[model samples]
Target: MSSDMNKDWPLYEVFIRSKNGLDHKHVGSLHAADATMAIENARDVYTRRMEGNSIWVVESKYITASDPSAQDPFFDPAEDKIYRHPTFYELPEELTHM
Candidate 1:
């Protein structure tokens, strides 16, 4: 297909959740005619090894994301909310993981 025709296909962002994973991780993007095709393509391309237990395909245009460049002001207010941090609990020195 021509580049322009390819661009007309909806862009899909793929996420895969492994059997051992608690959350889906964004694996990659692809172009597909529709959601069903997107999911099928994602499974064939990304989970051919049978590594993922679940898959998600979202059209790129529908996703809302925070701007990385605005991180300072966008997230600064949360920094002042000290209670949100888990620093109040004291762990025993013998516990290495904390």
Candidate 2:
């Protein structure tokens, strides 16, 4: 592999705003030399029609995510806790939207 191809750049996560959407959604990730290159690469790969007007590229190293394997310890304690659920609450007839 060439030096450029072999060079290990930081991974970047890309978000794109579709033509009709008001928010940018995470589309994919790629390894890039820097943020600028990542944006260009994301544009080429995600928005072929100039369909997206906004591009956000974040370093993968900075991304923090929840661990699914720890789900039981992380969230299950709240399952039997009925105070967290709203189903038992009664609403007034006049407050239909609420």
Candidate 3:
């Protein structure tokens, strides 16, 4: 592997907002020497047309997520408990949005 592609730099997840009317979305990832460099790289790759106003660079290592393969047993217990739902009670108008 190239020295630039070596283990020195960790992976990063890049998110960018293209315009005022659009929401930021995951564009792509790149190995940057640091956060600032990651942002610059993400801009070059994702906003070539000056397409974005905002950029977010998150180190992939910092992200913690549950395993999708365990979803059935991990989440299915709540599905059978219909009483947990508040549909039977009429909520006051002031609390309607809740």
Maximum-TM-score candidate: 1
**What is the TM-score (0 to 1) of candidate 2?**
0.70
lDDT tens readout by residue for model 1, 26-55: 999999999999999998999999869999
Model 3: worst 10 consecutive residues (lDDT sum): 89-98
TM-score, per-candidate, Cα-based: 0.75, 0.70, 0.65
Angstrom error of the Cα, residue 66, model 2: value is 2.1
Candidate 1 ranges with C-alpha deviation above 4 Å: 76-83, 91-98
lDDT of 2 at 91: 87
- Candidate-wise lDDT, in order: 0.92, 0.85, 0.88
Please give, for residues 1-98, the per-residue lDDT of candidate 3 as tens digits: 68777589888999888787788888788898899999988878878888789999999999898999999999999999999998798877887557
In what order do the candidates fall by lDDT, top score first? 1, 3, 2
Measured by lDDT, the strongest candidate is: 1
Provide the clashing-pair count of each candidate structure: 0, 0, 0
C-alpha lDDT of residue 92 in model 3: 75
